[model samples]
Target: MIRFICCLILLSISTLVSAEEKLLHADFRHRPPEMIVENNRAAGPLKDVLDEAADVIGYKIEWRIAPFARSLKGLKNGKVDLVPRVIKTSQREKFIDFLGPIGHRQKDIVFLVRKGKEKTINDYHDLYKFEIGIKRDTAYFTKFDADQALHKILLLDDRNMSSMFAAHRFDVMVVLDKDSIESAFKQKDFTDYAYADYKHKQNIGIFYGLSKLSANTKVNAELSRILLDMSQSGRVAQIYQNYKLEAPLRLF
Candidate 1:
């Protein structure tokens, strides 16, 4: 009877361990003065958020530094267990489930033109007045294509797009707000360009993206519970503070 009881306890422990299998992966990018890492370890606000979430859930994490396009492919292929951030859309719902949204909607695309020139456009009607720079295959442009107001929008690769704007091939260009701001600060010549804030307004919530491979309902529920608990206990705030990011806008 003693041996049988001991075996039962061991089996229960094994089950618990198996349930908490190592199942997290993250991507890396340069966000400057914010998140930077030498190897796979994190040293920024993004890393702090991911680490805190992992600690709360009792899960392990693996890191992969790759281009944005490659990282998306990795997530879709299950080569990546988690994507640190992404916009949740209906199209993506078919292949993955979003765990929770932890970040704000900060990724808005902006329309840029020469600083002193009256080249900025506001509405869709204004957009048709000039050639607009947009990325190929991005959802932003996909929406633009669907909109009747932007029928004259021009799609260009980054090099040709930005160069055309510099050369005045297009009177205006639409670029991500964050990227445009960062680029203006980094590039001296681009200083002459200014982005009008109202052309494309998209509120995108950044979520802890999960692949179908890690879509077990039980694990997802546990993760959600952990996140909510962290939010209530101020652990999430602590992590944000550690990285000098503004504390979460809302705990809920």
Candidate 2:
């Protein structure tokens, strides 16, 4: 009886340790190639590399889905622990700590229009002609984001973007990744769509934005160091390679 009681005590201690395991919260909204959701779990290059880094640093991740704005707000107020694919904006840098750039800022941003409407959106000035579908609380670029004259429909993160386009919900879709839109286009048999020709070739990158208020802040240097080492060791590139994407070269 005493041996059985001791065994129960050991089991209880193990369960307690498991329950106390440290977990960092991260925002997960599906953006393909860079960030993807497969079978209700986060996948893709960004999540992969981050996952590896966190595991090495003895941490687990708890992913939550929220609107882009709310995600940023969570980062600012310490509700969220990390946000991937974030550009370093002046206002955001004040509250969030960027690990480093993973991919070029303009490398993926694209504006898509329905067949025959591509010619109508050849330049930024022509955006005023119709309403555009834009994700809420997303930053595309400085001038475009700050423009108040354009008519934009604020879209939620969970909405069906392809179905909305098929239904003609808006005239344009500003996407962060070309592969995501292309995959959606192929899946919906909506291959007739074309890109709007306003060229934005900014070579800066988006980053892994860590929250200032989270316990993860304590391991900021260690995490950043591991990430830098990963980037240099080609592990970051290898992760991107699994998704058939190119890893950014300039990480500093």
Best by lDDT: 2
lDDT of 1 by residue, 80-184 (tens): 767655557777776666766564554566677778654456555677776666654345634765776664445534545666566667667667545534553
Q: Which run of 10 residues does model 2 get worst, by summed lDDT? A: 100-109
lDDT of each: 0.62, 0.78
Residue 155 miss distance in model 2 (angstroms):
1.0
Backbone steric clashes in candidate 1, count:
0
**What residue runs in model 2 are displaced by over 4 Å at the alpha carbon?**
1-20, 65-70, 102-108
Backbone clash pairs for candidate 2 read none
lDDT of residue 193 for candidate 2: 77
